[model samples]
Target chain A: MPKIVDHDQRRSEIVEAFLSVVARKGLPAATSRAIAAELGVGTGALWHYFDGFDAVTAAAYKRVTERTNERIAGASTGLRGLAAVDAMMHEILPLAKETLDEAQVVVGFWGRLAANETLSAAEADVSDMWGGRLRDHLHEAVDDGDLASGTPVDGIVDLLLSISVGQQVHAVMATPLLDPARQLALIEQCLSPWRRTPRQPGETVTR
Target chain B: MPKIVDHDQRRSEIVEAFLSVVARKGLPAATSRAIAAELGVGTGALWHYFDGFDAVTAAAYKRVTERTNERIAGASTGLRGLAAVDAMMHEILPLAKETLDEAQVVVGFWGRLAANETLSAAEADVSDMWGGRLRDHLHEAVDDGDLASGTPVDGIVDLLLSISVGQQVHAVMATPLLDPARQLALIEQCLSPWRRTPRQPGETVTR
Candidate 1:
């Protein structure tokens, strides 16, 4: 019998290594060679668990998205309506070093996705997942009277999704107004109009 | 002279070739060899004009920015305040065939920019340029009473910039609500609050 090799586990390790490279040295520096070295293997070794660099990137993209989903789940536990919505967005936004690394990795994958057809972008899934989450939380907010009864939920949902995608690239671009305070301010800017009460000073949960 | 070689003209042609490749195919296909082939030249010839593909990309990036600047200038020639702001945003947003192409090119360059330090992303120049233009027109809107007198102009400017950047990636991602009508609706969403009058029917330009 051949030595048992956990392909799934090996793939997961490769994905984790790719992410480690991105986190330590930004997206551009997270090339295949770097990922291989990070794993203490040769460049060709990555191919054993993955088809190619694109496949590795695709896996890393999925990993990041899943990680984000898990984080949102953890952060929004026991929260509802506006509270849940805010917590989820906080987890997604690059408000801290960890989330910022996630943003960089996501943006890099998006770049490659635009150029490569073989890799899956899962664009619809991402949009739908977030859109659904936002809709549920937003409608709950309205039900709780935290948001106005006549709030344009659908349009607001689209706007928030756009902002989420935009901020991901903006993170790598190092665009100004990228600080934690300002990132939350954007969420405030979106929600303020419908808020039954305007956000008070010191109300923002700055990370 | 041993032979006449218009270095400036050749570099321009190379930049144009890169852009044409991006427009004709897409960002991923616009590799150095393809760009050279587009110009009916060997791959080796591109090096005479550019340090590397990175330089070609940087030049292409500059070319696109200048072109956008020109379009914005042309579009807002006789407008001011919110009207001017709307006109410029129309040019910047990926609302139509031409502008959408630009958004793709810009987004692709941004991806490369995140990875390469030598390429000159010109992040500040882009932000400051649009920031100043938006500030000027927004303040004009405030002065002209098109916007509320106490409107938060700076925050509004930052918000607009974020939307602009967001919409670029949103274009590539083909995120829902990318249609011209919805794109314009976002602008309307931003301005509606400050508008003394709500957006009347047919107020938005669909394309």
Candidate 2:
């Protein structure tokens, strides 16, 4: 049991080293050689830990997903309904420097995800996890009279989840689509129609 | 002039072959060796025509963009306003086999684009091009009395453009977000609040 725990610890350290390389340099620069260098080990050491580059990318993808989930947990603490939804989305949307860097790292792995089913299959369906949480927060909003009855919560969940996944690549593309004000507006657009008070455009919702 | 024409012609043929390999197999299968085999040539022939795999991918990305633009023109011919928006989006949304395959091809290149600035720089900005078109179409819809007088046109334009680009990768993810109905619903979700004749939950906007 101790040996297995040590093995897991080593894998986590390697994945962290990979992310640090991606953060300082860009993704292409985060080669096995670079990751090994970051850990003060030989490139051959990475192959001993991971199957290949694809395995490292998949591990990094999962690491980023877990980090975002942790942030969401922190952001939504003691909040519920539209307020909670707004806070949770803010964590995922790449608005700040940390999340923007996370977007860059995750978006780089997506092409590999598309190409390799074995690697991608090992990762869970993000839509289900994020969609499930967003759906719950929406229902909480409805219960609190924050959103109207018959608010099409399911459709809104789908809409927001799509935006969550979509914006990662948009931020990487460095388009106006990644603009914070514009993204906040889209999030508001989703909730505005359902809000009881129906806040006006250009008005800040939570933060 | 003829020699220059032939060089361009040859590059186009190689790019087309790359697409063929991608369409029949998947993105990862569309390798230099596979592309050369698809054309019954050696992999060295491919490098002679293009600088490298990154160059081949950039060319293929540009080719796909041109092809999609051509489809948009053909689909939207003699159409305007919301009708044209629906048609143009239908062509881009990866709802069909051709577009789904195109999505696989383009999503694969995004990783390279993020990695290589020289390669990414050669491509045009998709947001500006697509956003500009969607913006005009939304204005036309408003002018024709199809949408509300005080519709937040710019916000809706940004929302729809984000979805259009975002859904390409989403579809490649093969989640429910890729569901044609769900995607079309997301589009309708954007237009619904602004429509003069608001669409009901189950109602179809257009064929």
Candidate 3:
């Protein structure tokens, strides 16, 4: 029998390559030719996976979001209650080099997505999806009595999403004077006001 | 003698042209060529006014920041106490079609500004410049007993900037359901938590 490859897996591989290319180069420079060159494949082969630039760009973003969700989900094992929520919130910001790189690429895509009507809808949907997930986590924490009473669930959700986006924006805009470690410290400090109990201060962890 | 163009005047005109082009197109689409076309001038004329694309982009952002500060300054009149502070907060968000258009361009510029080093420096300088002014205004309000005592100045500043950016992001990403009046209502609602006194039943204005 002839060897059979998973088409979806191959498409994901192409999208991963596309994200790497976007991370190194700005989105505008991540053209089909550039992505193809980075993947070490002919442009025609990339097209077999993606119909056009829009499809490829959308796929790249979807891959990033999916991988990010997976990271958070995978970290929840053997931990429950507030510990899971804390871990998820910590993972929300880009702590690792790989996650930071992903964040940089995601921020780059936001600019393109904002202006392009075709992508704008998708971007809004993705944002709301993330917001919904964060809200669910907050609600669970509230039910578990790990979060403060009278704490607005949706507001916390918005705060988490906004702060995460704000931190990435700060990372890309600010000088390396404050790298990921310093930033995570600032964020954790800001979040102290809303926490049910004080978190012992510590340096950032790469998981 | 024939009319002589001053350097400051010409620079302002060039920045205006850049903003208009960016407002119509987007940050990425606002090339020197497109800005010149929007200005009804040649690329050579634009170069004569500014050094290059980076210079123009920086200048354009500076001009917008100046305009926004001046407008906020004007809103400070005819009000006392927290009323004045709330008035200024209202103006920061886009209250009119003109400001709304400018904000769209400003929000789009943020992502590109994050990705580009030169532009990122310019943006940080602008943030510091504006944040400092805000800090000063807040300090004055505190001294005048218009704001609550013991409020963290920097926290207020961050909150203001965050909400400002958050509202713009919402406007850009979500459908414009909140009219200007309704948007003002939401602002008042957000401000309620910090106000020193409770409003009379159905009272729209603070005494």
Please provide TM-scores, in order, for all candidate models, with all chains considered together: 0.93, 0.96, 0.75
DockQ of each candidate's interface versus the true one?
Answer: 0.55, 0.67, 0.30
Worst 10 residues of 3 chain A by lDDT: A184-193
Question: Candidate 3 — which residues are off by over 4 angstroms?
Answer: A1-11, A22-34, A42-55, A77-85, A175-207, B1-11, B21-34, B42-56, B77-85, B94-96, B136-150, B175-207
In the range B81-110, model 2's lDDT, one tens digit per residue, is: 999889888888889888998988777777
TM-score of 2: 0.96
Tell me the spans in candidate 1 whose CA falls farther than 4 Å from its real position. Answer: A1-5, A120-124, A205-207, B1-5, B120-124, B205-207
Q: In model 1 chain A, which range of ten residues has the least summed lDDT?
A: A115-124
Candidate 3 TM-score, true structure as reference? 0.75
Which residue pairs collide, candidate 3?
none
Name the lDDT value of residue A6 in candidate 2: 81
Q: Candidate 1 on B1-207: residue-level lDDT in tens? A: 323458888899998988887778877788888988898989998897788876776777788888889989988887888888888888888998777777767776676776675554444378778989899999998898888898778777777778888888777777676777888777777777788667678665322
Ranking by DockQ: 2, 1, 3
Clashes of each: 0, 0, 0
lDDT of each residue in A5-80, candidate 1, tens digit only: 5778889998998888878887778898998899899999888877777788778878999999999999888888
After TM-score superposition, the amount by which residue A145's alpha carbon in candidate 3 deviates from its true location, in angstroms, is 3.4
> What's the distance in Å from true for residue A94, model 1?
1.0
By DockQ, the better pick of 1 and 3 is: 1
